[model samples]
Target: MSTYVVTGCAGFIGSNLVDRLLAVGHNVIGIDDFSTGQRRFLESSLKSERFRLVELDLLDIDALQRAIKGGEFVLHLAANADVRFGTLHPRRDLEQNTIATYNVLEAMRANGINQIGFSSTGSVYGEAKVIPTPEDAPFPIQTSLYGASKCAGEGLISAYCEGFGFRACVFRFVSILGERYTHGHVFDFYRSLRANPNELPVLGNGKQRKSYLYVQDCIDAILLAMEKAPEKFNVYNLGVDSYCEVNDSIGWICEALKVSPRLAYSGGDRGWIGDNPFIFLDTARIRALGWTPKLTIKEGVLKTVEFLQANEWVFGARD
Candidate 1:
């Protein structure tokens, strides 16, 4: 069994990936800072002989290097996910997301590990002119400091691939939906609607439609890409084929909770500063690898709501 090192292993996507890897009998080493990721996510896996958990900040160069050693592949998922937080603390955002990525890449290089799968975002497109944005889409303007930092991280990885002769696959993700999402539009809606059951705070105008990928599908594609990854720098767009409006998602959340909530606008050009209004990913590249996402927006949302309902204790008691 190949040993795989996963950063941000306690986060939504990384934890899910670890579970999937363990199911297939892979030796998995997970490292997390527990800053935003919950330690509870790794609790169930602690008993497994195949699983190793290292609780350390990626910013700690020595600890990161030690954790990454002996891994065949590194899945880098640690990042400042809250885009809005960038406006308040831009340096923290850069340090955690961008600089942390640089640390990961350097650690990979030091260990002679050549394979890497990077997690980027469609936010890199920054006010895209093209519908269903492609992987090669031009990222001229980064509306958010968060997006710009990610773009910088991607550039660093791309250059490393060329400079160090390592193979890399960059997956530019859209809004990832599924269970275990601690924060996102859906999670927020669920929390708000559950609390009030009458009024929901909707960000932006509620007309911003976006492509989303279920976490399971995202994990599957990452593995598939690992199985069939090509030499040179390979970038793929990972997202659902259909786009759903923000208001539509709100409606779905209310329907799931059996509540009719009044929608209240938070106000803005986008949801917040640096939010993309409407953008879709042209996933033909990843789809060519014979990986198709099974969950539609509605289906994914429902499944997420079910998980949230069943695990009401996750966000603390429903009251």
Candidate 2:
């Protein structure tokens, strides 16, 4: 059984990863300050003897190093993922995402842990000219602080791999959807609908094209790559073969909730300052390794709405 230190162990993706790792009989050390992560997400993990939760922020380099001491591998998933609000707090991206990633690498180096897995995002493409951008697609000018910070994080990971003999697998993901999902457009619409089902405040023109992978599919890709794709450093774009419009998802969410809310369109091509009008990543690299998403886009959206409906408490918990 491997021992892994998963940063942001209480967040949506991190918590799900912790559960999966423990289920596979691996010893896991989870680190989180609960700044934006939910405690209830870790309840199942806490019950496992193989899992240990370290309540510490990643920015504390010394404490982070100590917490990561015995880990055989590091899964760095913590970050200020609030893309829309990034312009509001510019330093958050620098401190939380970029510096925090550097801290993870430093901690790994200090502890002699040379293997790591990083959660990166497709937003790094930054208004790409290429549709279904590939792993090798040329990077455009960074348009979002969240994307820029994550790009910086990727640079740090790559440097660590080259300089420190670290075996790194970096997965650049589009939006993710599934159980424990607490953020993004679907969650926002669901929460807003719950409060008043008569109207839904739609972001953008509702034509913003995007792609998402089911959380389970994402985890599967990660696990498969962790086993097969570490060669000094490797990069893969994790997503399905198809893309969906914001309106497509809205229909799915409302259908699941049985709500016919009036759509309030905020006239714009993009939702926020850094929101991309279209995002689709080519998953051929990961798919070549025989990993396919079990759930379709519509299925994933419906599932997310179902999760939100059953767990209305999450709305308040996030607040």
> What C-alpha lDDT values do all the predictions have?
0.86, 0.92
The runs of at least 3 residues in candidate 1 whose Cα sits more than 4 Å from the true structure, single-residue gaps closed, are 317-319
Q: What is the TM-score of candidate 2?
A: 0.99
Q: Give the CA lDDT, 0 to 100, for residue 186 in model 1.
A: 80
Q: What's the lDDT of the predicted structure labeled candidate 1?
A: 0.86
Reference-based TM-score of each model: 0.96, 0.99
- Candidate 2 lDDT, 1-319, residue by residue in tens: 9998999999999999999999989999999999989999999999999999999988899999888878998888999999999999999999999999999999888889998999999999999998889999999999999999999999999898888899999999999998999999889988898889999999788999999989999999998998899378999999999999999998988888788999999989999998999999999999888899999988888888878878888989888
Model 1 RMSD vs true structure: 1.7
Error of 2 at 221 (Å): 0.6
The runs of at least 3 residues in candidate 2 whose Cα sits more than 4 Å from the true structure, single-residue gaps closed, are none
